[model samples]
Structures are given as structure tokens and as C-alpha cells.
Target: MTEIFVKSLPLKDVISNLAEAFDTVYFNRCQEYQINIPEKYGTGFIRGINFDNGFGLLEYSCSFKESLSIHFSVNNIHPLKFIYCSEGTVKHRFEETNKLQTIDQFQNVIVASTSKNGHILLFPRNQKIQLNSLEISRKDFKKKIDCDLNHVNVNLRKLFRDLNARSLFFYHGNYSIGMSNCIDSLKVNGLDGFTRRLFLEGKSNEILSIQIEDFEDDQKEEPKRRILRKADMIQIQKAASLLKQELHAPLTIKDLAKKVGTNPTKLQEGFRFTFGLTVNNYLNKIRLDYARDQLMLGELNISEISGNIGISNKSYFSRLFKAAYNINPKDFSKKIKRNSSQQH
Candidate 1:
């Protein structure tokens, strides 16, 4: 396996430093950046969006073939960040305590506080990692809001206040179901230039807004959150992937749990804790999304689409599709055809 050597860069202005790390990094007319690292080690792109204000975003959808290890330190108050792992995993360990936190797929947080000390990020080989690092300078972030900080969500306000001190604070939770869908909608595979920048920045702010709402909801949770063993967490995630693979099959939750090597109770609670949706709700979401795409493609009628996705009741399928997308399946397909003809 070939290992890529990385030079140390500044952490305070993380986005700009990211711009410098790549051999093919450039800023577009919009001041957004496109970063392409050496291909021998990994393949894919990193997109960065910088606003006139200090708000910024760095989105990574790259996979490495060899392990990556880096040591870095930030002396200044680090940018307040909202980190989400939409795919793969990322681990962070501070040097002083060596305590670590791992963010798994579909998990998110408005970063835990960090000491001014150094930390290391490890990226294992063969894992396709997709991450969104949204951040703002502590000073700029504080200025962006006009209202009294104290009146904001206690958890959010507390996170900001932690920036002023030498201590670190950490909160790990899942984003709202709406936010998770938004995350899935971020398409970066073949995008370029202004369109890519527009989507990244717009969606970044939208996710940030929902993150604030998440923080408020975080305060309402009971003091105790169910803790799962690392092995159990892995099994739960395996179950989720299985669900996606067998999305059209009419497998009950019991079968799902058994296949993933966990009990029904753990499966339900784990789904709720990790993905912010129950098993049935999550399954329906993916199925409906698939049906909607099939409808847009004009490949199948409502009945075929519904049956293909394992919904035996045609009325119920239409109701579910309409409730989720606000458009009847038939009309959605009609609109797709009409637009295609108009373009022609």
C-alpha cells in the first residue's frame, strides 16, 4: 500500500489551509474553491465555500487506499464547527487526555469543545468517507446573531460560551430527519463551478439552521441517553445497510434485527438514537425516495412503482408518496414528461 505524506498546515484558518494542501486547488470567480489531491493515494474532490463573512464550509467525499495519520494543533479559539459524517467514519483524539470520539455514518454534532492542544485524525484505507465540516470564526459567529446569546438554546449558547474558556465541551447527537434528507440530497459526483458552489453554500446554511433546532431539542432529552457498546453500534449500522440493500423486500423488523445480530428492542432504540428515525419510518423514507425517482424517470406507472417498493396497497402508497413529497405520483410523472417535452 502506498502512503501519502502530508505537510503540517495551520488549523485556525482551516479552509484556507485546505486550499493550499492540494496540488490542483483553485478559487473560482465566486471565491469558492475546488480541491483535488494526488490521485495515487486517493480519488475524489473536496469543495470549499467561503462567504464574505467568516462562515465557511469544507465538504469531503473522498476515499483513500492507505491509512492517513496527521498531527495538528490550534492555538487560537478554533472555529465553532458542525461536523457530520454522512458516510464512513472519523475519529478524533486530543493529545492531553487521549480520549476519543468517533462519528459514524448519519451522525452529527455542533462539535464538542477542544483544548488549544493538538489532536490527530486517522483515516483508514478502503473506506469511502463523506463528511461536511461547517464552521465559523468564534468572533464572527458571535456577531452573526443580534439577540442576546443567553436567550438562545441553552446547549448552543453553552457551546459558544465554552469557546471563551480553556476547557472542552462535547455533544454528540443525530440531526433531524429533515436534515438527514437534506444531507442525502447533496450531490457532488459530477458537479462543477458556480452550480456546485451555490448548492454547497445554500445547503450548508440550511443544515446549520436545522442544527440550531437540533440543539434546542437536545436540551429537552432526558438526562440519560441509551449507551450502546461499540460492537452493538456496529451491528445497528450493519442492519441499516441491510435495510437499504433489501429495500424492496417486505422484511419485518424482527427479521432485520435477527439478520443484523441484534434483538428487536435494541434495533428500535438504536435506530431512533443513531438515525433519528424508527425502523419503519427510515425504511419508508428510502422506499418513497426510490419510487419518486422511478416516477420522475417515467419508467413505471403508479401501480408498478408501488408494488416494486413492497407496498401492496396502491392507495396507501399514493398517500405515503403525497405526504412525503407533496405531489401525487401520477402528477409528478406527468410534470416530468411535460418539462421534458418543453425543453425539447
Candidate 2:
């Protein structure tokens, strides 16, 4: 790891300073100034673009080779930063406050200028480090939008009205798996050049939108239907675990509920609320994922594997398998067999 000192005396300096300091930065068009840094602080990549609208997009997946501490004296004026960590944890403390706030795995932080001038962000080594951050220049962002940004989050509305204030406003919450998946897809895409610029811009906007939705969802006064008490939900979740471990057992909804010391209604509702799937559908997904592994192993026919996962009707199982993965189980099995034969 590098022992480093970085001071974005004003928030706007962070990006420009980084581009000039690191040689690993690469981008589509030299005109776009869109750069990707592969070995900043350690082994990982930071890819982003400096859009024409005076905003920037950034995604980070860096594992510090050793402990790295950042002392940032950031006096950000009108720039707003939205950061989400899908894998590791980041710790920070503002210059004015002793209270340390941590953005942990699957959590996010959205900060805009409020009444503070400086803050500190610390990244721990060997942590699962994955982050998506957006730095939007207030004046430029306003020029790009004609309507109020109220649809995203109420805090955004507050920030818009009080642009002159010099404070720090932030929101912290759990990020949806859907949001994590979206960022992961961006990390793995093969697109490049001008087309990559288009993709990056679209994804940057989407990530911002998703983070705003996270805050709005947090403020929901009305809870979703089928919500279960936390304690009882834990028991029901344990039952789900049991069902997964005993997939070959022909456990009905009623049986599973009884085994887990809850009613069928609670069982079904807890599964839906916790995992966003009905009990049966959740079971099917688990089974199908397992079946795919078996298909790749080339050890059993579709019928045998289907029976192993508690699906008996072979034809119906094939339908479910195809529906789940968009490939017939038989075809998937054959593909694996062919690949294996070639390997031998």
C-alpha cells in the first residue's frame, strides 16, 4: 500500500487531482476525459467519466495491499457526492464531529454540502472493497435539469433549495440487491470507446436514481403488506433454512410452518418480505440453481436431478428449469458433456 496524503481542499479538486496523479487512468475518448485507474492505492480498478455536464461517475473495487488511511480536508462548495459500498466498509468522521459513521457492506452514503467544510474518509485494508460514487456539480447539474429533483429524495429537494448553505447532509441505508447487481454488471461489461461512454453515462444516472430510491424507501411511512414481526420472522427464516437443507423432503407450506413454530400465513409472508419471493418460488429458485450445478457435473439425467430437488414430474421440471435459466435442462446437460469430452 502507498502512504499518501490527499487534500481536496475543495471537493471539486478530488477528480482533477486524481487524473493528474495516477498514470493508470485510461478512458474512451481523450476528449471525454473518461479514465479508468487500475492500481490506485493497491490492486483494483477505478473507472469513471468526466461528463460534459460537469458531473462525474466513479466505480471502485480496490483491495489495499496494506492499511490505507486518508485525511481529507475537503471544503466542498456546491458539489454533492453519492457513495455506495456493496462489498466492503468505509469509515469517516467530519472535522467538526467526533462521531464516526461507517458505510458498511451493502450500505450507502449520500452527502451534499450543508454547513461543514472538511471531513475524513478511511479505507481499511483486506476489506471487500466495492463502491459506486457520483460527484455532481450543483450549477452544472441544475443546468441539465429543468424540473425539481424531488422525485429522487426529499433531502435532494432540501439541497436544491438551500444551495448556498455550507453544511454536510447525508443519508445512510441498506442498498437493495438489485442495486448491487446493477453495479456488478457494469464492472463486467465488455463495451469500450464512445459506446462505452454512452453506457457509462446511462449507468451513472441509474446508480444515482437507485440510491435516491433507497432513501425514499427508507422514509416510507406505510410498511409493505405481509410484514412479520422481527423475532418471529427470524424463526420463519430458520424454517426456510431447514427447507433448503432438506430439499428432498416433501414439506408442504403447512408442514414447514408447523416445523418452524409459525402459521402458514406468517411463513409465506416472512419469506416474501425477507427475500421478495413466495415460499414456493424461493424454493424453486434454490432448486433450479442447484440443478444447474448438477447439469454441469454430467452425473445424472434431467429426471434424476429433478427428483433430487423434489420435482417429480420430469416434463414439468424441464419446463421450470428452462423458465428459470432460459435453457432446457437436457440441452444444458449436453453442453456440459460436450465441453467435458473436449477437455479430456
Candidate 3:
């Protein structure tokens, strides 16, 4: 494995140090710096930008020809980092320790080294990898915020106030959908100059907010369940769209799970997380909602509406509709017709 040592503070200088190690030049525009990996070592580039608020963003989209480790060995207190892996896998550990933690695709880690211990990031050889690191200098961030820390969560408050880097902190988990969307937006919209800087700054803050919220949610005392990855969320969304489009052919949980590339248990958990309902309950709600709209159109009778939504038993469908909307399907349809007649 090859190793590159980066001994710099702030983001711009970090890019410069990396460029020196890679034996390549770097580009700078509007305080953002970018450097491409030399052909001998790898392909792709690493971009970084530092905001006036002490927040910085470092994006890595590259692959190395051999296993590589970038060691951050700054002499002063290092910035707290929220590192996210969007593709492939990366390993991380404090420079002072041998234990390493692997961050896979769709996963993230919050890391702060004690004092100047620094951090080391390892990338496997010949694998496409994409990662984003949100770096925050606590001292600068505190001054920028210019607010009391009493309102913050206990763990986070301590983290924010530890400007001297008195203790170490680390957390790992699957990134939430909000964070996934924020990360995706960073790669879109061809904005440049001040507009691009402002856009990135805004997104940086948004991603921080989401990270804090997700950390808090993870701390809650909930039942043990599988953590949902971004891929799982996408599958869950596909299942929902399928359910809506095929209202006349409702699928069983196992079938729906198979179609969506997830198991029944994960499907149920994802539905509950995304929609606050189980899979069957969500499907039922969708069917009833669709039936309500059809009834309002006055083009289908109760029996036809029930059949259209894959409910063979009209009486059972009526019970479900009444439970959901507090009115029997027949009565709701009659009310719609009566209101139409009155209008005419």
C-alpha cells in the first residue's frame, strides 16, 4: 500500500499539498480548489472549497492503481469531519490507532480526533470511489454562529464547544434520504463563480443540519431493526409507484417485495419508515384514496369501484372506505351525485 502524508490546515492548502504529492497542478476559482490525479497513479479528481463560516467541503471522485492511504497530520487541532461514501468503500481510523472502520456505499461517519491526532483514510486499489467530507473548525464555527450552546443537544453541544479538541468522537450509520438528496444536489446545476459558491455554502449548511437530525434520530431508543440504506429507499419508492399504477392488481407482500428487490421484512420496515404505515396498510390507503376519486367522478358504481381497486368483496371494501373516510362508499357517491344535481 502507498501512503501520502498531508500536513496542512484549511481546505485550499490541503488541495495544494495533495497536488504536490500527486506531482500535478491544481486549479483555483472563487476560493475553490481542484486537482486531478496524475495518470500514473489514478484517474478522476479531488475538489475542495472552504467557506468563510469555517465549514469546508472536500469531494473525492477517483480510483487508485494501488491501495492508498492519505494521512492527515496537521500540527494543530483538526476539523471535525462528517465523511460520506456514495460509491465503493473506504476505511478510516485515527492516526494514533490501528483499528479501522470501513464505510461502505450509502454509509457515513462523524469523526473528531483528539487534539492533533489527525485522521487516516484508506482506499482499496482499482475500485471506483466517491466520497464527500464536511469539515468544520469548531472554533471558527462557534464564532460564526455567535450563539449560546444551551439549546443544542448534549452530545452535539459538547462537540460544538470543544474548540480545543479535548476528546475524540466518532459515529457511523447509513446516510438518510435527506442527506442523500443534499449530496446529489452538490453534483447538479451548472452554476459557477459566486453563484456556485453560494449554492455550495447553502448545501453545506443543509447537509450539516440533516446530519445532526439523523444523529439525534439514531440516538433514540427504538426497537432493533435493519437500517434503511438509500438504495432501500429507492426500492421502496418504486414499490409505491407500482402499487398506485396497478390499483386493479394489488400484489401480496412477498410478491411486492420480490418485484422491488427487497425481502418482506425489509419492505415492511421501509414502508413504515417512509409512509408511517405497513405495506398492506399503505396499499389499502392508496386503493381507498383512488376509489374516493373515482366515486367523485360519478363514472363508476360502488361494485365497479371496488373491483377496479382489486377488492373482490364489495362489502369488505365498503367497510375499509368507511373506516378511512368516515363515510360508506355508497353514501359518499350519493352525496357527490346529490351535490352535482343541486349545482345543476
Error at 229, model 1, angstroms: 19
Q: What TM-score would each prediction reach against the true structure?
A: 0.58, 0.62, 0.74
- Which regions in candidate 2 have their CA more than 4 angstroms from the true location? 1-16, 19-41, 71-78, 150-153, 225-239, 244-277, 280-344
Give RMSD to native, each candidate. 11.4, 9.1, 7.6
Instruction: Kindly report which residue stretches of model 1 are placed more than 4 angstroms away from their true locations once superposed.
Output: 1-29, 70-72, 112-115, 148-151, 162-165, 188-199, 222-344
lDDT of 2 by residue, 249-289 (tens): 65888888877876777688778877899899999989998
RMSD after Cα superposition, model 2: 9.1
Q: What local lDDT score does residue 68 receive in model 1, on the 0 to 100 scale?
A: 69
lDDT of each: 0.69, 0.68, 0.88
Estimate, for each residue in 1-344, the C-alpha lDDT of model 1 and write its tens digit: 33223222222234345545544455454665556655866877666667634577767788876876544456655656678887899776554666767878777756544555544556778799988877666655566664677668866676766646466656777655567767777763356667866777788788888777666755653322233323357778888888778766857998887787667766888888788899999899989988988888887888888888888898899899999999888788899999999999
**Best lDDT among the predictions, by candidate number:** 3
- Steric clash count of candidate 2: 7
Find the 10 residues in a row with the least total lDDT in model 3: 220-229
Best by TM-score: 3
Candidate 3 off by > 4 Å:
223-312, 315-344
- Ranking according to TM-score, highest score first: 3, 2, 1
Error of 1 at 49 (Å): 1.7
